[model samples]
Each structure stands twice: as C-alpha cells, then as structure tokens.
Target: MVASCATCQQKAQQVKAMQTNIDFWPTTLKLKNSSDLICDESLRYLAGKRLVCRGRWQQRTVAVKLFFHPKSAKRHWLREKQGVESLISNQLSTPSLLFAGTLIDGTPVLIFDYLSSAKTALDVWKELDNDEARLDLLQQIVVEISAQHRCGLWQQDLHLGNFLISDNQIYTIDGDGIKSSTDGKELTTKKRRNNLALLLAQLSPNYDHLATPAIEHYAATSQKNMRDLKSITEKELPHIRTTRRHKYVKKAYRNCSEFIRHNSLRQVAIYRRDADAGLIKQFLNNPDQLITDGTILKNGNSATVAQVTIAGDSLAIKRYNIKGIWHILKRCWRPTRAWISWGNAHRLTISGIDTPQPIAILEKRLGPLRTSSYYLCVHENTPSATDYF
Candidate 1:
C-alpha cells in the first residue's frame, strides 16, 4: 500500500512538471541537489520534447538538459547517465556530469560542467585550409574513436560535430549516441569496420588519401589486425554512402534541418537551409533580370545559363526556358529536368562525390502542373571533368 502511494505521487509530480512551459528562457526550476536552477539560454531545442540550456546552478555556470516528455523521458535520461558513466569507466574524455536526477517536480534533468571556450570539431575542420592539417585532425579524431572502440563503446551517430575541442583536447559530446556492442571488451572486427566506415562515408572521395592512413592509425591504436582493411572500407563505404544518400534525398523535398521547402498554388520552391534567404528571394523574383545583368555562360533557345555573385558567393543559375505551347503541354504536366538535376546533385553530395552544391530549385506551376524550372548551384571556376581527364 505504501509503495502504491509513492508511485502515484511520483506520477503526479511528473504531470505537474510537464505543465511548466520550456519554450521561454530565463526560467527557474528547483533542483533536488543544488540551488534553484535558472536556465538563461537555450543551447539546443527540440520543440516541447527536449532542451539543452546554459544555466546557473550551485553558484556556477553549468549546462542543463531537461527532458519534458513524461513517458519516454526517463528512458533517455537513464541512457545518457549510463553513457557518461561508461566513458568515465573507460577513461575516455567527456564533459563531467555534475548531477543526474529528476527535478523537484519529477522532470528529468541533467547538469554538467560547461566548457565555455570549446569549439566543435566541424568548425575547426572548416577553418583548416591545407590537406596536411586536415589529415592531422582526422588522425587525432580516428585515434580517439579507436580508443572508444577498444573500450567496448562507439558513438552510433559518429560525426565531427559530436566532438568538442578545448585546451588542445578532443572531448566527445552527445552521450545519447554512445552505444556498447560488447560487454566491456574490445569491439569485434565487424563492428569496428562498420563504425569506422560510417564516419569515413561522410567525407568526399577527394579525401581518399586520408582514409588509408586513418584506417592504418585505427588498426595500430586498437591493436587489431586488419589485413583486409582496404577490402572492408572499399566495400562498406559505398554501401554506407548509398544508404545516407537515400535518406537525405527523402529530406530534400521537405522542410528539415538541412533544407527549407515552400509550396504554393502558382509556384513551388526548395532550398538549402543555410542558403541566403534574401538573395534567393531576390533571384527568384527577377531571375531573367538578374541573368540579363549577370555574366552569361550560355544563351541557347531552350535553356539559359548565367553566373552571378550574391552575398559574396559566386553562384551559377540555369533556367530551363519554356520552348513553346507544345513544350508547355508536355512539360507542364510533369517535373522539369532542372528539378531532376537538383535532386541528383543532392544525391551526389550525400554519396561523398564531388559536385557543386545544389542550393535551390524553383518551378513555375499551374496547380500541380509544372512549367519552367531553375536550378541554382555554387559556381566552380575549374575546367570540366571530362576535358581535364
């Protein structure tokens, strides 16, 4: 009878906490172990479900993660706690977890020491200009990853963004992605191959030279004999790339983190989320005028190509001009070649192939029918691959 009442009270507390709105920042909450926690800035947010914020706790600035969902929150909370504990037990570098427990009202909360000056590995990699520096960075990253695999753990969503650099050290973040495939034993050869391939697949084939040395370093650090290292990565990289390409292609036509999608009765548009919205709007509004003012690359009857500079970015715009009334009758009932190229370009990108990024695709439409379409991409000054080869 006493146990039943405790369970009921816990449920009640969770319900009360769920009522507390998380969308607004500078909100205060009572922590069970420390002072009243004040969440001042949202570092990352996922609607009503999860929030990572910088907050004040115990007279110190700390990072706080609050899980608002009632049913699934506890599971994720325990996973994060277990992941952090695993890293600590394995002597891997990660942010120290200060506290892990429910809030006063039973909302799951985790507090950690915040590294103020840390930059994500992705940002640091982007700043590196030369291939040698980039290779050195990759070496350091794969070595750390090899250590984790040896310790019987690997990040399921391994990527450069999950690592933080501070004090000349790389600290892995996103505890939730840390997964164990073995019972405190080194990962099996198959697991190591797949995990390493997943990370390598994120890089273009232009980095092919880096992959050999990186895998060699992994084998050396993990003490694993990978006589078939070349065969493994060769077979696995394409498979991973194809899988990722398929997934990202599905996101190309929708509003996701990487792409912005807009649709209307008269027009439909899709663009990269990181693209300059003002420039895109201006170009789309007066594409012909811009093409007239910009440098012309091609001026054929059925198509036109122009190079334009916008917001300091050199861009190539191609307009698939409407041929005539007969062309409209056939093309208006279906998607244009430009739309196809836009999706194909994204496929190439996701497959770790070198190609200019497809920034946006716009189409003129009558209801569901499509007419003239435009494809936008980053301008490349190099010679065509066929001619160069």
Candidate 2:
C-alpha cells in the first residue's frame, strides 16, 4: 500500500535515529529544488541540511527518481515491484522498502533509509589509477552478478552505474529493472550472455572494441558465483554431521548454520549487480533457446525472439546469435566455472570414486565451437534439484 505523509514522516524519524552520520530532519529543512523535476537534481537538502534523492521511497530517505512523465508510472511500478518480490521471495539480500509514492507536483518519489558509504563501481573506477585494483573490483561485481543468475533471477539492467559498493561489498539500488521465473529456475543463458557483454563494455577502455581477455575474465568469475552458490545452498547444507548423544542440540546448530550460509550467499548474489543486453550477447552464441515459442521475453534492443523448447515442455533453452568472432572471445571467460569443476573433481578423486559414476566421454571435433577436447560425466542424484530448493 502507498504510505501516507505521516508514515513517511515516521520513517524519516526512524532513519534519523538509525543513521548516526546524516540526519534527514536537519534543523534547516530546505527544499533544495523548487524547479520542475530534473534527473540530476533528484537529490536535495532536507531538514537539518541532510541530502536525499528520488528512486525508491520509504519512511527514512526517499529516492527522487525522474519520472519524466506520468503516463509511464504504472509500467515503472510493476517493474520495480517484480524486482523487489524476486529478492524477498527467495530470501535474497536487498534494502527493504518503506513506501513508494508521487509528490503533489506529480513527481515520483521513493523514501527509505539513506545508506552511508554505498558507492557504485563506476564511482570507484573514476577514483582508481591502477589497473589491478580496478580489475579486482570488477571481479567481485562479476561474482555477485553470477550468483544472482544462479538464484533464478535476472537483473534486467545490469550496469556499473546501478550498483552500490558498501563495506567492501556490492549492493543494488535500482530495483526497477529485474526479471524472474515463475518456478524460480536459474537465470537463462541469454541473460548471462547479455550481462557479460555489459561488464566487458564497462571495463574496456575502447568503447568501439571488445576485449577478449576481459570478457574471458568476467565469464570465469561469473561462473564462479554460480558454482559457489550451488555448493553452499544445494551441495553442503544437507551433509552436516549429527550426533545421537545431543540430537536436538546438533540439529539446532545445523539449522542455524544452514540458514546463515544460504542467506549470506543469496544476499551476495542479489544485491550487488545489474544486468542488460550487452551481458547476454557475451555469454552465448545463441540466446533463442532460453524460452518457449510465442513466449514474450523482454528485449532491450531488436525484436524479442521466440523461445525454444525441448521434450515438449519439460525443458526450455534460449539462444542468442552474437556477432563478430572478436566479440565472442572477448566475452567467454569461465574462471569461476573452472574452479568449481576442479574442486568437484578433486573431491570425487579424494573419495576414491567417480563423482558421476565415470560417465563416458564422447570425443567430437564438430559444431561452431573451436574446441577439440571435451568430456561429459553423469552423477547419481542423492538429493534432487527440487529437494535442495
């Protein structure tokens, strides 16, 4: 429900108490902008000479987003709500919403606690001179992005500007551009590819040229986020050793630990990244197999492609036809995936058995992919996919 002015005032008070750094209800109480709503001027001084902006509104500090026109308010609201619901339903991490509303002047406003020390990667990039330091920051971002996809959610507009870095970690501020699945499956391949492209573009110095090494680096890290989340939530949670002597005590400890781990991973994945068209292009050569035919998928540019289905309806795949050989290599890093693969392989070897019963490795030097060496293995399911979720 839309919050009332009294509720907004109460929220502002709570935010005042929580934030020892900035006071929203400063003694001065200045309405900094008397002009019509401007995008950059969305932030202004409030009571006690405190600063706040427009975006998502709540009781504490409001996000003064540039609505531009009222005709689009309904669309924006639905998009924002979908994004918020995905994170909240999955128990993923993000800032809680206090309220959303429009000003008397027809300007859109969102109020919530004004976070301290939350800077975007782009904000940090401008401050750094060393290449290594910048790369480290981007790597963390890619990791977070990958985690988000693994959780069956997509950041519809993944970009550096939309992310906020606080306390040595990342947080997402723009919730109006997120996508999700009805059944909560992992993000589609198309989404991953587009996100990688966006990351590459942002990190690259040459706007016109795509960097193969940078793309590869991002892909590797992105894959790592997925693997890490899977291991923690799906793989490790159920295996906690228990003792009969202290059954209740052990059970309680296990439950608590699992909750902490799962939520921690979810927070890392959901709150720190933004996604878009560029990223999807980098991760896949074809993004059409991700959804079903006649299924409406959102597209940033160009027409939305029909979804491809396998085995009638049980499985669906989305594919993208990425252009340029140089572009493809620049966006295919798989470091995180490799690490997880190696770790899994090591664990199986240590157990003196094949992890997937040593499934046959079929050798093939076919298809557009330029790889002559590849292997596939199958494993018995102890706890199936649904069980873990």
Candidate 3:
C-alpha cells in the first residue's frame, strides 16, 4: 500500500487538530489586498474547516470566510469565487465580493460587504411560528433557488442557512457550493430532485407533510410540470438520512463539532464539546459518590439514576450496574445500556426530535471490551404532557 509522505502526515495532523478547537474567536489578520483587519465574533462555523466572521476592513463592515482546510482550502475558495461571480453575471441578488485575498499565514479568505440587518433563512425559519408563515419562508427560499437553477447554477450546500434575508430581499451566500452545467443549460429534472431532496431530508420531520407543497412552490417558480419530482425527491431522501446518521454516529464518539473524547487503556469517555472540563473531571473522579449526594430518582440493582447539580448545571446521571456474573459477562463484551442511551439521545437530538441534551457518556472498559457505563444529560424542567395538557 502506498503511504503518505511525512509532510502530508504532519499537515493532516494540523488540520485534525484545528477541527477540535471550536473557539476560534475572531482575530486581527494582515491581508495582502487592503490593510490589517480585525474580525468580530464568528457568524457561523461549519465542520471546523470553514469560518464566517463579520469585521471591519478598509473602514467598511465586511463579512469574511476563512478557509482552514489543508487539502480543500484553495479549491473551495476558487469555487466560491467563481460561484459569486456567476451569480453577479446572472443578475442574481447576492453580496458583491469586496476582495479575495490570502492571509499572512497563507489562509485563503473571501471578504464581502456585510449585510448588517440580514439574517440567515435558517434563522428566519425559527421565527415563523405558524404554518402559513413557515410556508411563505419556504416559498421565498425555493424561489431564490429556482432562480439559481434557471441560470444553470446550483448550490451544492443547498440549505436554508446559505440564504440571507434583508428588508424582505433574499440574497444567496456560500459560493463554494455553486455548481454549473458543462454546457450552461438548466439543471436536469433528476439533478433538481436530488438537490431538493438533500434539503428536504435535513428538515425536521415536523415538515414531512410539507414536502409536497414545497415542491409545488418550486414547480410554480420554475414554471414547469414537476409532479414526478416529488417521488424522485422522496426516493433520494433515505440515502441522505443513512449518510447523515452514519456520519453523526461517528462524531458522537470523537472530538468533533459536537463532542469530545478521551481515550485510555482503562476506559473511554466522551463529553459534549461545550461542557465544562473541570466539572467533567470532578464527576469522573467519583460518579457514585456524586450521585449519592443528589436526589435519587431510581435506585435499582441494575441501574441507578439521580438528579445531580454540577457546576451550576442541573444534570441527570444514570449509572448502569453490573448486576451479576452473567450480566457482567454480557455487558463487558458490548456497550452498556448507558452507552446505548447516550447514542440514542444524540441521535434524537440531531434528528430534531426533542430530548434531553446529552452531556457525556462514560464507558468503563478493560482494553477494548466494555463493562458498566454512565450517561449524563441536561435535566430539563418542562412539565409532563399530561400535566401541561
């Protein structure tokens, strides 16, 4: 098998290390085009490889994209540049690029006029409390998307977040996803279906019934008969779900956008990336003792659950007991119930099904095999359905 060169290996490690640092706060950078710019807090961070921040450049408020991915940084930057240029050429409403420059550290960055009053379509989605308001928002989004499709351009990352709304005017962002046809023709029906399905599959299942109406809006905007696209879109959804589920399940076990992991021969522990490290360390030292001090919800031989307060956060921690010799042998070779619960909680969370926020999962393992485990989640205070009703 061919092996990567040492330089490639070092760069890969650096990229991996950067992904773990989520607090990549805005900072000042010396640019090649204008002058040194100071960035404010980040606008959005995606998968740790790309960052969007708004800051002042050349005495104007500007939005910036800093590409830090070692392998795809330059390529994605070029694609983004091309996409923005294509949108402008097609007369699409989008932020005009002020300058494309490289940082002193050789990071590729794009600077644009910051839309001060604008909010992402995803943010707008959150405020639409009624079905009519939501469908209107979806119509606006698909209309803009329809315009892009008509111009032989499509966003690969075709999600609500890529569009921005300002004064009722919608503008597209994230040019890296701009895809174009070879012959500059409109996207085919199947291509449109898949792209639409990508967005649909990611939507919270609360909107499952809205998918057909959404397509109707898209069809009306496109001015075509697209009754078949609905079926095609539905057919494409499972693939996206399977892919997303597999990717998210992997992230739950490692130091990624959402969770952090600590590996050792004795045990493997994963905690929420935003969780307090000190509190986790304290809880790790003696979880049983910590539970003893809290209000016990269920004190059973097989499992114990308690309402514990740690570092000012109300948390519920469940400890899966070993029970007996047979139980110990069975669980030792596989994931404890605590481990499964942790995974399921996160799965529900990412699917947008409401569940308690999972804070940590501890697997007490002997080398590779596992024994008893503990699961920690934020203690929610919402009333039960029966009581609320």
Kindly indicate the candidate among 1 and 2 with the higher TM-score: 1
lDDT of 2 by residue, 285-333 (tens): 2233343343544443322333333334222122222345564464334
lDDT of 3 at 33: 60
- Give the winner by lDDT: 1
State the local distance difference test value for candidate 3: 0.80
In terms of TM-score, the best-performing candidate is: 3
Query: Candidate 1 on 27-141: residue-level lDDT in tens?
Result: 7888776569888886765433576889888889898888765456778888888888889888999999999997876678899999999998989988999899988998899
Tell me the RMSD of model 2 versus the true structure. Answer: 23.0
lDDT of 3 by residue, 1-389 (tens): 12434443444454344334545444577887647977776665555467677888889999988777657778888989999999999999999899887876567889999889999899888888888888888888888888988988888867888889999999998887888989899989878888888777767878877788888999988986877676844588778766776777777877776667889988888897678978789667778887899899889998899998877889998998887778877768777788788778878876879999888888888898888788888888778789967
**Model 1 spans > 4 angstroms off:** 1-56, 64-82, 99-110, 130-132, 182-184, 228-230, 280-299, 306-316, 350-356, 379-389
Each model's lDDT: 0.82, 0.43, 0.80
Which model is ahead, 2 or 3, in terms of TM-score?
A: 3
For model 2, the superposed segments whose C-alpha errors exceed 4 Å read 1-41, 44-68, 101-108, 206-389
Residue range with the least summed lDDT across 10 consecutive positions in model 2: 265-274
